[model samples]
Target: MKVIDLRSDTVTTPTEAMRKAMYDAEVGDDNAHEDPTVNHLEDLVCALLGKEAAILTASGTMSNLVAALAHTNRGDEVIMGSKAHMFWNEAGGVSTLGGVQVQLVPNDKGGRIDPADVEAAIRPDDVHAPRTSLVCLENTHNQCNGSVLTNEDMKAVADVAHAHGLPVHVDGARIFNAAVALEMPAHELCKDVDDVGFCLSKGLSAPVGSMLCGSADFIEEARRWRKIVGGSMRQAGVIAAAGVVAVETMIDRMVEDHAHARRLAEGLSHIPGINVDPDDFQTNIVFVGVDPNTGSTEEFTDRMKEEGVLTAYRGGGRFRLVTHREVGAEDIDTAVDRIAKVASEMRNAR
Candidate 1:
């Protein structure tokens, strides 16, 4: 049996081109700003995101942590959507390591925090209130079925943050996905934000690393925080070379992933015991809801695994399936058939 892993885009392996590039990459001490390939990767990200400078980090979590450390002081608060990846998925590193408080504003189904909500969440300049120093957002928000936030959506929140003298940071782990979905440039999507961090390892299919881009001064500060967080690397060009290829070659191809996700969502919707809205299939992530009458999400996932179809059971009667370079249209059909069989068996058993 073939295993169709729909767990996450992070499961993707490096391409042959990426491997070859890694083998041929020039290397030096990246900690001293001397790794030519790492420097080139950073330059590529800066150009793509329209930032003055950028830094490479070990992971998206590290990029967010470094951004938090660089943008806020201890005891300061950062505002973000209730569903922001930093708040839910990053293991509370910002608060634990940086002493920064995370203030949550309600996120709509579309993964947007209302600009008015952001305005209301800002703290007054008072002795008792924790200073609101930063605003954070996620593009193609992971928790919201990979919903893509538009350029205008970003600008509205950024305008409010800037008005309050706060810097804005976007956890753009899948910004290129958002860009492809919107038929816009990634840099344009991030034009109004102060800082943005994007992953090379996710849908981009690089084997490792994420990039944090901003002004040169901010990047200098972030570099210090990167070292503090133990993210400083030496001779990292070997991996960074793949990142260069991911940027240059992998971005435009993401439309295929989006199509596969839509197809998967539509297919799953036909299953009697599965619930999904194909219209909400915006990017590469599809969130499927299991009917309680059929079984719990845990049981559904276990059955799917038994059927050679792997998915992520995101508690609360939901499962998240992500499409990447490895999943094909045929694989989508196979997964749906497997899932349908599982759902039918579970429903009939009930």
Candidate 2:
């Protein structure tokens, strides 16, 4: 049986075309800004995100950390959503390495942080509070069932931040997914923010790389910070070449992944012992809630693994299922059937 891996889109394999591009890539030292393929990929991200310049990083986490370091001085506060990936998942690099403070605003179920709350959270510079230097947001927010933040949603917060003399950075790891679901261009989606970063490895299906886009000065500073964090790569065009192919070809296919996710969520909602609402899923991630009568989320995940389906338990009786390019409609159907069977057995055991 073919294992249907629904843990995350980060597990996607690169396309054959991407492999060919990587193998045939022209190379030079990226640290010297001489890698032609990396230069091209940076230019593509700049154009795609409507930024004056861009820089390449090894991962989305590095990109976000670089952005934070570039935008804030030590001891300055960075405001963001409470459920943001940077805060919850980035190992506190900004706080630990950059000496920055994190101030969180509540994110709604749809992944929007209220502008009023953002404005209210900004410190008054009374010498007792840390100065608010930056605001961060996540598009297709990971913990929020892949919910998308509209440009207006971003702009509202941006306006508040800008008025307070603060810059905004968007952790756009799955930004293309947001653009596809919103039917908006990537440039338009990110225009309001001072900096935005996206992963080429996730929904785009590239083997590795993330791109950070911003103004020329900002990118220059971010590049310096990236080097400080040991993110500078020599002769990195091998992977950057695949990133070029990813930006050129893989963005449009995210719509299919989003559809598959919705199908899986809808099907899971119908299954016994699982609690899910199809309407809660907008992009490629579905959060499956286990009822009290059902088995533990970990137990269910292990049982699904035995049945040739892999999933992730995201704490609190919720299991996350993400759809990617590798898994198609048939795979989703098979996964749903097997999962429902497992749920039935678990309920019976209970």
Candidate 3:
């Protein structure tokens, strides 16, 4: 049987075009800003994100870390959703390297952080308080079932942050997915924020890399942070060349992935032991709640793996399945069938 991997979009491999671009790319020392291909990729990303400048990083985690380190001072605090990738998935790099504290606002099931809650979370100007230097938003929030934040929602958060003279950074790792879902331009999704970081690896099908885009001065500072974090690369155009193709070709195809996710969610919902809200399905991520009577999350996932389908079990009974460039509609159907069979077996076994 063919294996279907629904684990994450990050598992996507580069395309044939990307491979050719990588092999033919021009190169120079990127640390000196002399790599022509890398420079083009940066310029292209800046144009796409509507920022004055952009810097390429080795990974999305590095992009967020560099942006965080650049936006805030040591001992300052950054406000974001409690379920944010920065707060949960990333290895606490901001607090570890940037010496900043995190203040979290509650995130709704749809991944929206209430602007009022954000305002309340900002610290007052006092001697004893840690200054609230930044506010962060995640568009196409990963942990929140791949919820897409609207431009108005982002602007509302930015309005509150700006009133207090705090900059906003968007952890836009899956931003293109948001843009495609909302039928808006990618840059519009991030226009309200001071800085934005997006992944070229996920959904876009690039082998590796992310971009941090912002004002020229902010990026210059972020470049320093990148160097400090040991992210600066010489002749990085080898990978950046593939990134160029991703930006040019991969974005428009995300709608297919979104549709596949919806189909998967719909199929899983029909199965007896799986609980999923197809209406909550928006982007490429699907969250399914497994019945405790059926099995533990780990047990369900392992059984699915045995059936030649892979998935991730988030804490609690929630299992996450993500659709990407590689997985097609047929694959989603196969995964749903395999998962349902496994869940049914567990229920029968009990």
Candidate 4:
């Protein structure tokens, strides 16, 4: 039986071109700002995001952590949506390592935080209140069925953050996905933000790394935080070379992933016990809801695994399925058929 893994885009491997680039890459000490390939990757990210500079980190979590460290002081607070990857998925590294507090504003179904909510969440300049130093947003929000926040949605929250003298940082791990969905340049999506970090590994299909982009001064500060977090690398050009290829070659192909996800959502919606709104998903991630009368999400996912399909069982009767380069349209159909079988079996057993 063929295994259709819809767990996440992070499972994607580097392409043959990426491997060749890695083999031929020039290497230097990246810690000393001397790795030519890493420097080139950072330059490419800066150009793509319209930022003045960028720093490469080991992962998206590290990029977000470094951004938090660089942008806020100890005891300062950062505001983000309740459904943010920073809030839910990052293991509380910002609070634990950066000595920062996270203030959560409710995210709507589409993964947008109301600008008024952000304005209200800002702390007054008082001795007792934790100073709100930064505001964070996610593009193609992971937990919200990969909902893509528009440029206008971003600017609305950013305007409020700036009014309160706070910097806006975006955990743009899938910004390119959002860009492709909106038919806009990634830089245009990021134009109003103070800083943004995007992943080379997820959807981009690089073997490793994420790039944090901002003003020259901010990125210089981020370098120190990266070192403090033990993310400094030496002779990293070998992997960074793959990142260069990921940027140059892999972005446009993401539209195919998006189409596959939509197909998955539409197919699964036809199943007897599955609930999914095809219109709710805008990128590669699809959220599948299992009817309680049929089975719990755990049971549904377990049955899916038994049928040779892997999915993430999010709590509260939901599963997350992500499509990537490795998952083709045929694979989407296969997964939906497998999932439908499971759902039907569960319903019959009930």
Question: In candidate 3, what are the lDDT values of residues 95-150, reduced to their tens digit?
Answer: 99999999999999889999999999999999999999999999899988999999
Query: Each prediction's Cα lDDT score?
Result: 0.95, 0.94, 0.93, 0.94
List the candidate 3 regions with Cα displacement exceeding 4 Å: none
lDDT (0-100) at residue 9 of candidate 3? 96
- Minimum summed lDDT over a 10-residue window in model 4 is located at 310-319
lDDT of 4 by residue, 1-350 (tens): 99999999999999999999999999999999999999999988889999999999999999999999999999999999999999888899999998999999999998899999999999998999999999999998998889999999999999999987889999999999999999899999899999999999999999999999999999999999999999999999998999999999999999999999999999988888889989999999999988999989998898889999998746698989999999999999999888988988999999
Highest lDDT against the true fold, candidate: 1
Instruction: Judging by TM-score, tell me the better candidate of 1 and 2.
Output: 1
TM-score of 3: 0.99
Clashing pairs in 3: none
lDDT of 2 at 312: 75
User: Backbone clashes per model, in order?
Assistant: 0, 0, 0, 0
Stretches of candidate 1 above 4 Å error?
Answer: none
